[model samples]
Target: MTQPYEVFVQWKRGGAHEHAVTVTASDREMALTLAKRNVDVRGAPVSIWVTPRSEIAQTSADDPTLAPSIEREYRNVSWYARERQ
Candidate 1:
């Protein structure tokens, strides 16, 4: 049976992989091939990933449980970094 897969493409080395497109295929191999051809047809992507959609988990944007519950400034290190000359 075919399943829906999420495609992610990295356009440059050391860059984050962002969602590119979705494809339906019977297997992982086919999904990758389809994504490669259609997602970035004009140029080459540094890397590509095809994952079954059902395997992903995400929380709703409106969920309040992820909000910072308390002040945690002590844990932050941005101020400790040396300023560039």
Candidate 2:
């Protein structure tokens, strides 16, 4: 079976880029072809990137290692919640 890969695309300048698609392909060339085809179907994408799925280091589904140990009041946007009371 072909290796798993992930694709990302930039739809427009200054727009926050996002994941576009995921596909299995033999190599980068094949992945690019798939990405281009998707771009055509989804309209023009400003930029594209394809990386092997294994290359992406990510947090585990059940891992909270990145969570802050202490609660931060400044980080709370819900401060308005108290005002509404």
Candidate 3:
């Protein structure tokens, strides 16, 4: 049976990997080929990663634990404005 795979591409060396596309394949080799053909037509990517979708873990934005319990006022733009005054 074919499985869904998430494709990630790195545009250049030392660059962050970005989600390029998703492909369904029986194995990693096929997924890589499909991902390269479908997403890297211009050959711009320096690296590619194919991970099974089922293996990925995701968290919801609505989750209360997603943010820190303590205040982080220094990270806010208002904090900078207040400091300038």
TM-score of each: 0.74, 0.75, 0.77
Q: Residues 29-80, candidate 1, lDDT per residue (tens digit)?
A: 9999999888777578999999999999999998988776797655567544
lDDT agreement with native, every candidate: 0.88, 0.84, 0.92
Which residues of candidate 3, in runs, are more than 4 Å off? 75-85
Over 4 Å off in model 2, which ranges? 75-85
- Which tens-of-lDDT digit does each residue in 1-85 have in candidate 2? 5897799888889887688789889998899888788666888888888999999999888786777779776577787677678
Cα displacement (angstroms), candidate 1, residue 52, comes to 0.2
Q: lDDT tens digits, residues 8-76, model 3? A: 999889999999899999999999999988886757789999999999999986998978789997998
Clashing pairs in 2: none
Better of 2 and 3 by TM-score: 3
Model 2: ten consecutive residues of lowest lDDT: 74-83
Best by lDDT: 3
Clashes of 2: 0
Count of backbone clashes, every candidate in sequence = 0, 0, 0
Ordered list by TM-score, greatest first: 3, 2, 1
